[model samples]
Target: MEASDARVVYVHGNGNKVREDLLKSQWDTALFGADMGAATRMAYWAPLRYPAPLSDAGEDPIDGGPGGPVGFEAPDAPAAEPPDAFIARTLAEARLDATLGGAEGLVPSAPGATGDPAEAEAALGEWLRDMTYLGDTLAEGESANTVPGSDAGLEALPLPRAARTAVFRLLVEHTFKDVHGYFFGGAGPAMREVFTRALDAVAVPDGGALVVLSHSLGTIIAYEALRERPRDVDLLVTVGSPLAITEIRDILLQPPAVPAGVAAWCNASDPRDLVALDHTLRPEYAPVELVTDHLVTNDSGNHHGIREYLSTRPVRDPVRAVFDGLASGQTQ
Candidate 1:
């Protein structure tokens, strides 16, 4: 696994409250090791939305500190409050706002929830996996997101308002603006800066592989960025991604698209991870030649956690292949 010339760019997803260095260090430790943090590049962009001089007091201010369960630990805390309560508290606390734009797509598509608990429950279960720490901290109640039924497909379930708002504000609002703007709205320099920085981090040697690892909404960002600006990518790994969500596909740079130079697109998601509600991108991405989807089940109660997805065979197998290719000077 001699990767001296190869590079791995990690694009983080939503609700990142820790400092970039800390987040980068944590992810590096999770993905590689203590020393590898410096080797792995982080596309730090949380500050783009929540600029410096950060504060806990504001209508939509980000709260950053060392809190909640770290990594993919199962929740053993008592379920005294409903999942929504913890979500509500997290929403109030996260304050992930869209300063330049407002809400978009699916979040508004189903404003009010439906009575059939089956679909909603299944979706909620998926979302819960992302916020398992909230599951650990809150007291259980009846109204929280608790999805039932077989986890499958691109249907818009009747998710509760609290849960809906939380997802919308944290993941949707935070990412949709940049992505949509970049493709449709003729995004300005800020978005350009993001793409610029992403490309700059690669610095892959002439024959070395470029591995782009993205989590949650970061999948959207990485996909679109690569699609618009075609480049050499040996492996594109998306964990806990929402690329299959019909709403996202609707306004993508190229509807039903894949990046030009990407050798392989490996999408991994837990069936219960609501963020990855759609689960499979093979259908929408069409032909399904280069794309492969994996059902990496999370045993740690919260399946949506990036750490859980990272630990699965889906991520490890392809990643190993890429490194092996780099070592052998061959493209798989």
Candidate 2:
């Protein structure tokens, strides 16, 4: 192994309205503090899926590849019923979740998973049995473990089926849209362009020492890009990610569940984060030895917020390790 300059690339999780500057500022503050300037970049794809409102009026997607921020927007498709449906579902859930105050309280996830790896695995096994998908991963006759994070601490009870279904549906919508855009929706090249730029930018004094911080749908893009495009990332951080969720996993480009050039994978989740319904990744990606799961406090009104995860020690420690490696001349 050799040491090289490490660059951080960020992929923002969810939301149509997030601005790149805002995302960059928040990530910079969280991952590197406000003062430290580092080799960090972001792979932005929100403008592809989210259209600006008429009142806010921004440039539309065009042939040179969508308008707005040069690397942001993607070609707009004909007005479809799905967007309308997504809006309706989101609004409906917003009302219901607000009323219940279940957004933060219902899912009392453990602060972190420590001690026996086998013990943590056993606990997740017990919890999944109560969920809709993935019950067979556990071996026959495993013992139940105390629920942690999003999976526990509900001084209250679980959400009703309807509320849960609404949350699930709303989330499922984002994954579906991302997959559609990244593959068939003519947005593939746009995403590839971002990866290309970041990879090139990171090749500073050396050739390719990269770090990717992908959130929500960006995780899907990063995974596919890392697999198909192939680059060197010393550390891969997924914050409030949906990669473990069955909806997205079923659609991954490669079933390896791990990217090709990543030296280490760190998965940080706030169990209370609705989008990260499936917080653990090692179970599905067991062949990989370097995946570290960090269950941290989101500290946001809504547990799934990316800023919250980015600020946690669990997330920063892994990223810092990469920079430390870079400083020591450790190469991937």
Candidate 3:
């Protein structure tokens, strides 16, 4: 059960990424501080969403390459919002423009209206309350009053208020686009095929462990793929995942449970990662006793980058232990 015999398969999350080999190399370095060489493989799904790999000239914006923001940035023309009502509701809930009519369904009184002063005052009071609620939601995680299907509202993120809102919007737009594409846009089969092929490509010797590490939207892909086509996975680690979101869980293979072939499941998230707003899987996935959740501080500006998650001790330790034959029960 040496590290060399254990194989790791990584599935990336949403957004355009660098070339496949480079992406794999970056992950290897992040997890182990050196190239794992043949010990690891990546299920590269970015090409399915982005027609081309990000240029090597430091233009990669998804994971904060040289020219991009420290973390993520929305593309020049962000993908149109998907048609899902849940997504629309989340966006409307997070919108900061008060003049617009959608912020908690409160519309500002008409400009310079001669309406009754009492009515106007009541409307203003309601608007102020809604704004305060939005601020509170961001400051403290999701409020108990959050809509049933909505994501955990954005946290008191490190970025400026405006930047945080923009990032949240972008994350939502990209996440739903990718999630919707795989589940509803006929991309599921192809993406799952890529994952299955990657898993198959890794050659694990007898008694050797196979770990599946998935992030963000990739977690959804890995989960569905493994459910449809089970594999003997020693450990399934999901980071910055959206699996707990009600809408996402609803679309997953019914009667959710740990994939039959998976021995242990660990879910990790940064408290500030909007994509992984829910931060736990045990509550939703069955055989809940087998699922473990870990909270790690992701120093990356947006707090959801794969490198940040992978490098965290809480995440990397279990993977290392499994590979080293030291892991028992649930390593996390």
Per-model clash counts, in order, read: 18, 16, 0
What's the lDDT of the predicted structure labeled candidate 2? 0.53
Model 2: lowest-lDDT 10 consecutive positions = 147-156
Clashes of 2: 16
Misplaced by over 4 Å in model 1 are 37-39, 52-192, 299-301, 328-332
Report the lDDT of model 1 for residue 72.
Answer: 20
Q: Write the residue-wise lDDT of candidate 3 on 1-332 in tens digits.
A: 33447899999987788899998998999998888888899999888888888776544444433344322332332222122322333334344332122222112233444434334334433433443344333333323221112333332222322333333334445444576678767898899899999998888887678999998889988999999988999889899887875445656765678998888887777654567655667767877766777656564534466897888766787788776663333243
For each of the candidates, the C-alpha root-mean-square deviation to the true structure, in angstroms, is: 9.1, 13.9, 10.7
TM-scores, all candidates, are 0.63, 0.61, 0.69
Model 2, span 1-332: residue lDDT tens = 22337677887654454466655766778777763344677676666666752222332221012332211222342212132332333344344323323223323323342423335334433332333122121112222212112221111123333344334444434333454566556776677677667666655556436678887667767777788877767778787776776545655667855666677787776544556666677667644466766556553433455665676766776677666767775533
User: Pairs clashing in candidate 3?
Assistant: none
Quote the positional error of residue 176 for candidate 2 in Å.
Answer: 6.8
| Model 1 residue 36 lDDT score | 56
Q: Where is the poorest 10-residue window by lDDT in model 1?
A: 141-150
By lDDT, the best candidate is 3
Q: In model 1, how large is the Cα lDDT of residue 100?
A: 12
Ranking by TM-score: 3, 1, 2
Pick the TM-score winner: 3
